[model samples]
Target: MRELLYQINEHLKTVTFIIIRDNNDKSEAISDYNIITLKFDDIIKSVEELKLDFQRYEDSASKLAELIPRAEKPFKNEVDELKSLSIYNSNLFAHYYSNTLCNNAFNERKIVNNSIFHLITFRSIVNKSKSNIYSLVNCIKDTLFANWSFKNQGEDNPLCIEFNKPIRYYRIGNRNEEYIVADAALFNFFFDFKKALNKEQDEDIINCSSDDNDSDGSYTSYDVSRESSYENNHCKQIECQTFLFIPRKRKKRAKNDPCKDPVKTIQCYFRSKTHKLHIQFPNNNEPEQELKKSKKKFYKKIKNKVEEYKIEKQSTICPEMKKLLDEIENDINKEFENIKYKYENMN
Candidate 1:
């Protein structure tokens, strides 16, 4: 709760900015002082309350998306398709009204609630009826897209997951090396290795091929320079070096009932042509007394530091915003002058 309060303090400014920029069209700006002060408390609370259900939806959505095609007619596995769809739709209430962005400050919570509601019910998107295979396939495509979009919102590239290391590597790594693989390939559209453009796509392509999208594995490192949208939005780390290689399995497999169907294990391999990265971290060892401090005391100190940082950061709010606005205005003026200069010279 204390950590959340700290976040509320940090995010309150962004919420205020959103209201300010978006609320300007309202002619009664002077009378709208109340609208200018926005609080993300309710929004955060609502999100936290439903966070678990949203997570479950994501998991089931992935499962249904992977198997929807096989479950459709001709294959006639309607049981799986319908059951998965039922699971998906049942959770739709979790994000019931998600399509529209909140344009009104008065209804900010509504907008946020709707957006989050829409974000997690990610798989229900479809076009046309699911009557025929063509339509069903098309609709399935839509479902896949929605699921992908919600989870990997900022990813610009579209591609499937491919394996870097094969089955043997994962098997050996898991049992022997204490490194395991994911049940499925997960495409982390939020691939944030700052490098040449081509390599970024190269990086994500390998991730798209997983059976379970979110799994942990082995690490290798690569050089990281600038932070990408993924890092800035999600991670606070300044450097990057290693990546985990997770092994994936067949999406469709036999269920329990060993007498009828034998269990299967996914193969793992180490021979991946894609290069491995060598990760490094500085060993900033603390003093013995500091290291020996109680966790509660350390946490309190860190909390105080974070609070102080927020307090200091609040002072920069106006100046920083002014600087950005000035830059934009200057750029506009420069563009206008350049065009005028060109025209005058040409005449």
Candidate 2:
């Protein structure tokens, strides 16, 4: 509770630039009053007296707002200045009261009560409907969207979670049975897709496949950068290296890597059951393919490539490759120790 009050007080300091007139009609900054530390004693007592619910929070928020004195004239009669001031105030409120910037705020606690209200309210509505299950799910989606919108009111890039497309609800069971059914894929959509863009230091593979939408596992990577819209907002295309291999179960690769070979010439796979690391190289290629290099040469090539890329630590070129290499080398050293013991025992 002390921390919350401290946070509120800290935030209040920034918005205390509101100009107000004193008893002598002399203009002075609101900061001169030293009202930065917001005392919530009265509000807390009021809330303690009332029932703990959405109505209580609503009343509390209104009272809290009343505590912050509004300047009759924050700026001169210039329209642009007024507009800019309004934006600044809105941003401050949005950052603290709304989830536009983050979810940690006093209003977020209020939203919890709102969510409970929505759930109970929708439960009654769903009970009256003929299709209970489907109606309940639809209500849940509606509640989530309502909360999402309420929290992100003043956000510039508000991310929305919804079905990829409208689901075609069909009647399930016999005609006499009143039950609506939709594909299970609808529920899977929320988790399988991501709307957030990857940052530069992000270690995740960039998936850049333009074509091949229906994941049959024949993956390929290409240098394609484009802009596309989702929910009417323009989003840059995913540039992660493994964006093409979404449906394929594969290990992570370096980001923005120059190598785009479909077939991995050198790869490491962990054999948990055997306690071993399987290092496959170009020499292990089947179908009697032409040998690019001997095993020693291939090992040298891999070593040189790792050194050339400076894959000793996490960097922009390959953030996660160093950790992966370390794990592989650790296992390899363990196996070498076992081999050396066996050789010594035989001698």
Candidate 3:
């Protein structure tokens, strides 16, 4: 029995040593540093001796059971503690090794979030959907590299790879300017990543693919050109300029809110100024008349307020107050001019 126990102890100790050495080697390779060294042989021998001692106690208890018939409570506690200690040691080793590798990868610029690679996926999907794929591709490349200053970190980490599955986008309505809806799983993934990266919700990110078409024979597509310059950034910029297309049953308009008003209803359907032309207005003369009326009303209100203030002050307004008001008016005009300049040079 003694010889059998001794041999078992020796084998267990050898196996434990091998496991410790392998773990250390793996840690070193990943971190590129030899920071941890364990005398596994010595540690394993001590653990084996404890195991052998416990086995002897178990054998003694079995023999004692025939005579006394009571549980070995003390040995059970010791064995539980030994198992817990082993787990604690393993956890400590893992924590130290993982944290080191994580820190090193961060320093080397290799541990970026998964969203960076998704931008590439965005580009690929857009390129596949477009008739002029090369032009779209070039435009995206220019925006990503030149405009937003994006840089790539190689695939040393798993986060650098594309998603495990392709995300699907569906068009919501028959309108050409409709927003696309993404699959639930894809939406969750995008939502989580955007939240983590502090990126704004982009219409392009959920763009409709040409593959999905609504019953009215229209598909939703993305237009990167329509994205605001202020909102376009390295992390949020997407290349997919085409809209998504989804199918749905025709919706019935309420009696009070009839769909006959294409001018008003179309405003809610499309996003851009160009698409607004699709909705036929009641008459061209109405718009001109409305503009003239609005301008006249604005000037009339301003003049009435100024006249009221002058009457209250008995036409003796302070010179400093007048100068201050003039300066404020000048500043407002200057700001308007600056805004005009910016808009003029936007193209």
- The residue ranges of model 2 lying beyond 4 angstroms of the native Cα positions read 1-104, 111-347
Instruction: Show model 1 residue runs off by greater than 4 Å.
Output: 1-38, 71-347
**Error at 247, model 2, angstroms:** 8.7
- Give the Cα error of residue 117 in candidate 2, in Å: 15
Q: State how far residue 299 of model 2 sits from its true place (Å).
A: 22
**Clash count for each candidate, listed in order shown:** 28, 7, 12
Summarize candidate 1's per-residue lDDT along 1-347 as a digit string, tens digits.
00000111222331221111233432332234422232444433333333322323333333333433232342224223333443333332122211110111113323333444465553332211112223333332233223321222223432323222211111222362211111111112112112122242243323434445354432222222334436543334333223433334323323332112100000000001000100111121122112223223323433454455468764323444344334433443444345445444644
- 2 or 3: which has the higher TM-score? 2
- Model 3, residue 66: distance off in Å is 78
How are the candidates ranked when ordered by TM-score, highest leading? 1, 2, 3
Question: Which model scores highest in TM-score?
Answer: 1
TM-score of each: 0.18, 0.16, 0.14
> What value does the lDDT take at residue 13 in candidate 3?
26
Q: Write the per-residue lDDT of candidate 3 for residues 266-304, one digit (tens) a residue.
A: 222211221122122322223222222333333343355
Q: Is candidate 1 or candidate 2 better by TM-score?
A: 1
Question: Clashing residue pairs, candidate 2?
Answer: 205-241, 206-240, 206-241, 206-242, 206-243, 207-240, 207-243
